[model samples]
Target: MNDTTATLDAPTADDALTRPFPGASPYDTYVHASLLNSLQQPLTEAPDEMGFLVTTQVMELWFTLIVHEWRTARVAFAKDDLDAALDALTRSRRALTALSGAWAPIAALTPARFNGFRAAFGRASGFQSAMYRHMEFLLGDKNAALLHGHSGDRAVHEALGETYREPSLYDEVLAFLHRQGRPVPAHVLDRDVTLPYRADPGVVETWRQIYTGPQHHPHLTLGELLTDIAELVTRWRSEHVMVVRRAMGAKPGSAGSSGLAWLQRRAARPVFPELWEVRGAC
Candidate 1:
């Protein structure tokens, strides 16, 4: 073929796929990848510090996602939409699993490696993560003292204060069940939302009925799904403790908290109390 004919006939199929954007790639623009990359300014020269910072930041993102899903689930339950709530809970469960797996990179850090950069981040601790606190609040682990701790940041404190006053994911779940004619106690439904949730015998009995009833019931399905979320949350906390123990071996945590011991205590607390109690009776 002549040069003109050959050139015209040449494949143009891949041009659109390979075309460059006017400024930034669509993916970068949408995900703010440039901004995210700019955030990992590690303060140490330690080889492991970068990985540690990245892993911790990634976990924070996962925490944000889990909190978002939980809030969605809570709203769904409040609206009496069980299917939507379950879907959101399932998403959070997957996020929790991924969050636990995030420990893999730093899980085996030697004391020397950890010490290489630990002091670089003075007074900064994972315990002070506002997003993580949001996750805890959603799980009915409300602590007014913890809420007050963030008061120095007015915006964060106000936002957390709202979560403190609002019904938690578990609270909405129980209210949904009560609306469906389950025998959840009036006192539980009336309890102040600001306080940390405590297990009630009436709630245990309510769960017991659901557990013993028809296996295919929707309430039973909800119980199992909630149990799954709780297990995943506990698994993530336990993994955190394991990672800390390996890295520092009971050294004091940043921000003045007891490191391993504090994490151990947190990991020991049950996520949904009545759900577990109902199992023994079943």
Candidate 2:
């Protein structure tokens, strides 16, 4: 093996604690881990509450990172900077995988353990997570009802409402493909930006062209990257459903929906529907 590979494979001990630094280590100043640690104020004495709170906060941070990456990809796509877009997408994919894994801390909580702290928070649930909604909006999961859920908080509602009105990252992608000589329909490209993206047959055909084209083409690489992203998004939803099922069974959600059942329906739908549909034809 090469020296670089061997070095990467080697293990190092006491690398963090043994290191010396000035006031507030560089990581602390940048990441504000100390400030973050102070935010986990569990409202109840339940042992599981801390894990649940921390897990949710961690997911929020991942969601924020994923949203930032997606916005970068969207701008790169708009400028026809395919390599930059691809780099951003790859970063978002890794962030999405980490986000999915963030469920572990609270993944297997019993209904009893969850109940111990569920009522203490009243109507607060993951459903009210603004950063999570930002990630969804970028994926074209725009929902007016979900945006309205934050009306009590003017700043949050305005930010979410703006996203709800904007064309999603997928919308920008199709526009990019059209400029690259794909046959994406003008109607699909011009559809109202406020609505949730639905599967379009013409869009499916456009993806089919990419799939049927010469192997190793850049557009095909783009398609595969998008597929990876789509799969990751579905995985997150599935994991959420699993976590909710284990913690609440068929009971109503803290947000008023039929907890596991509601999430099950949401998880059943694909994020990039046309991307998945095109696979069958190819």
Candidate 3:
């Protein structure tokens, strides 16, 4: 190549070597990596604390992404936009997997290691995570009681209340299905959106039809996408239980819910209930 060709190629070749931005690079401007890097202020000198704090924060970020994507999916389904809904669900599945993988750093912390730093950060726990609650609400696990817990913080409470009153991503899916000629019942479609979603046989039958149909069908693809999401979320809960067990045994959570036992029960509850129930019939 000649010098002109070489100069044109220089930009591509020197991508790794280039640091000559006029100010911050577009990436830094959009992603704010410098600010993110400065966030890990571990409260104690304990070696394990930083890892624990970062892991929790990483999981919270993943929760935020998943919630955002699920809301995207919900709105898409509301409009009968299957492609958009699937795209969002696909993004959310990746986020959930990342969220589950985040447990690795603190996965092996023994009770003594956890105790070394746990007390320093008083009155905080995963139980108090607003982002995680948003994820749960997106999955149709609407708990008015949990939403009420955020009342003291008006901004958090109002944000959470919006999700609480809005139809869940799953609810929108059923509505989309109904529009597509599926037999989602009148009561289910018209039910109070603020109420916690209950598993209905009608919803289960709708999934059964999709699952029993052509494996490559679009609706079936949606079913599988939802199943993948459900399984990943359940895996995260299971990991949380294991981590909490290893870190604190049966001790109450810092936010006060009988830690291991409470998480165990919460983990036992299934997500996308009809998707799983349909499997037995299919």
Candidate with maximal lDDT? 1
Best by TM-score: 1
lDDT for 275 in candidate 1 is 97
List the candidates ranked by lDDT, beginning with the highest. 1, 2, 3
Pairs in clash, predicted candidate 2: none
Better of 1 and 2 by TM-score: 1
Model 1, span 36-151: residue lDDT tens: 99999989799999999999999999999999999999999999999999999989888988999999999999999999999999999998999999999999999988988999
Q: What's every prediction's RMSD, in angstroms?
A: 1.6, 6.8, 3.2
| C-alpha-based local distance difference test score of model 3 | 0.89
| Model 1, C-alpha of 14: deviation from truth (Å) | 2.7
Give one digit per residue, the lDDT tens place, for model 2 in 1-282: 999999988778857687788789888999998999999999899999999889988888898999999999999999999999999999999999999899999999998998899998887778789988998898998888889888999999998888888889999999999999999999999999888899999999999999999989999999999999999999999999988888888998887877888889988978889889998999
lDDT of 3 by residue, 11-91 (tens): 675576666888887888999998888999988889999998889888878888888999999999988899999999999
How do the predictions measure up, each by TM-score?
Answer: 0.96, 0.90, 0.92
How many residue-pair clashes does candidate 1 contain?
0
| lDDT, residue 78, candidate 2 | 96
